[model samples]
Target: MLHYIENSKTQVGKELVLMDIGAEYHGYTADVTRTVPASGKFSPEQRVIYDLVYRAQEAGIAACKANNDFWAPHKAAAEVINKGLTALGIIKNETDKHPYFPHGTSHYLGLDVHDRGTYGPLKAGTVITVEPGIYIPEGSPCDRKWWGIAVRIEDDILITANGPENLSAKAPRKAEEIEKLMIEESAFNQLELPKLD
Candidate 1:
């Protein structure tokens, strides 16, 4: 997976891209991406909806326990995103923005991002990413109030005999959660600065 930020020289526009590529030794592939604001902060409205995406991701991970179907996480994440978005008045119904988040939540992770394996069910020792996202582009069918705002929360996971383990725990998914962590780290750095005699 790759995350990138780009600044425009001619325009007041910035771009962020997250790309995930999966290949399989037996012939399979899984690819996905999620773009977001790079300034470490989202607009007020964006935050409300973005939090929903984060929650969906967490729910997906939690559903990846042993004895679950390989597609369970995706279904769980999608339901969370749909219900959350609907409650926030962003989407009218669960299947509203089907075009944007049409892809599955988790895929096999090995040689390819969507590694080759049996898709029927999930067994212990499977790795994947549970990502839930919502994209609102200009002139979309939905309300224009949220145009141009895209939010996604993705995390790598490993299915275990007991449950699932998150691999990308280092990435921040919450608005206040991220802000607090960043602020604490910044303060720590200042305190560690060399003292001037």
Candidate 2:
């Protein structure tokens, strides 16, 4: 799906594209998502929100373990996100009631984007997605400096005997890395196309 944001107040805007891809090998499927700035470089406000979400995702990943329930990662990430919004003065109090962060931090990932059976303790072979996002719709009570910024960071994770493993870690998750990667030309760009009616 595509989410476009335009804000005169923040003096910046972005066409955010969110995609989920799945591949199968030996009858097993994997799902992953990567979000990047359409402009190739994040504005100051965008960077702030993106970084906060990145940190929250890290916390969520850390919570993935054989001993923790499926909801543990959500709880850990939500705590960080809620506190971050408050510390940035985006909200009135230290609470997770903020409308900006409305979704759970994770969900099962396998053959489907949201796989089934995400209820009890996580299993060692289970795969899940840790995605934390902030969406500030226009005309909110917050200052204009924080207007029209939306960011979502997602990674496919595996609960292992040692700890959580980021299967998509090779993908760029940081703002700088994303910007650099975006600027590089892709091999597909060189493909020749024939005019067919």
Candidate 3:
């Protein structure tokens, strides 16, 4: 559910679509990810999870400052997610080994999509990504309403002496902002492509 099959004949419907995209300019590549509701509106339950993930991403981004260890972001994000999931009863307690958040929350970015680094303390001028997510697939242990819900929000952060700077700040992450943006016409709507047989 985190990604779509290439050219799959399926519709997004009212479900959420997660796009993990990367762009290259000159020699460096930038990676970004965003999840949006297909209906341009989020169900109440979906909004809860999305908002929780958003808060977790914020915590992670805050840990992206210089002098922090490379793992600081993931630790901060995981702490928020663990507590949020506990409050939602998705996990029995904060210490429960839940499957909801199963990945690291940050990584280096530069020439390579996943740029190489020492994985040591963060330093000024370092560019990285802070992504936090919660995935509840069908038939999960929790209530049926949370089933098939997956949300991920990623932002590129630059480690600085002052603090972290969001390079992708222009991209909308708020539910209201996304809903507003979705109301606009997409330039791709007019494109026509030949069918491959």
Candidate 4:
């Protein structure tokens, strides 16, 4: 994926686009993507809502435990986001038509981004991402206050007998956490850079 991003720069746009494909040894494949701030630092407003989305993602992952239904994570994540947005003044009411979160909470994740599977009393083996997003496009109602901004957090998880296992735990989703990691990593790289011989 890194090689593709680096070499195929001409094929991509300035905005970050989450695009990746995965294959399992057991003949399963998965693909997912979430656009991020190319600069690696989200604006203040973006961070505020992004954190809520991350929290929702966490809630969804936590709901993927054994005996839970496939829809459990979706419901959990959506509820979390809705609650957070309500508190943040993004939504006037629970059923209000606000653009705060315009996407589904979760989806079937396997060979396809929206994989097909029985979404029922969850079995021991299920994988999905609880991605919630907020897109306030220009000239839109929500855009009046927060325009040209979008935030989303996606994580891959596998249901287990004990609980959910995060497959994409390496990715940082927290606002402060991500910023700190980026700064520390960048400093480390700079310190390791050799002076021009």
Candidate number with greatest lDDT: 3
Model 2, 1-197: lDDT tens per residue?
A: 12434432343247555555567767666766666777777778878888898899999999999879999999898888888888888997876377888888888877666778748899998999888888887887898777767788888899999999999899889878988998999889999999899
- Runs of candidate 2 with Cα error greater than 4 angstroms are 1-15, 20-28, 194-197
Which segments of candidate 1 are over 4 A away from where they belong?
1-36, 95-97, 180-197
| TM-score for each predicted model, relative to the true structure | 0.73, 0.85, 0.93, 0.73
Write one digit per residue (lDDT tens) for candidate 4, span 1-197.
12134554553332333434455646665544454555666666766766777788778878888788777887788888778777876666666666656667667777666788777776777877666666556775543555655666677787788888887777655677666664655555556666788
Instruction: Name the best candidate (by TM-score).
Output: 3
Better of 1 and 3 by lDDT: 3
What is the Cα-based TM-score of model 1?
0.73
Task: Please give, for residues 22-57, the per-residue lDDT of candidate 1 as tens digits.
Answer: 334476333433444455456676776677778788
RMSD of each: 6.6, 4.2, 2.7, 5.8
Candidate 4: lDDT over CA atoms?
A: 0.66
State which candidate, 1 or 3, has the greater TM-score.
3
lDDT for every model? 0.68, 0.81, 0.91, 0.66
lDDT of 1 at 129: 74
Q: What is the lDDT of residue 9 in candidate 4?
A: 55
In model 2, the Cα lDDT at residue 55 comes to 92
Q: What value of lDDT does candidate 2 attain over all alpha carbons?
A: 0.81
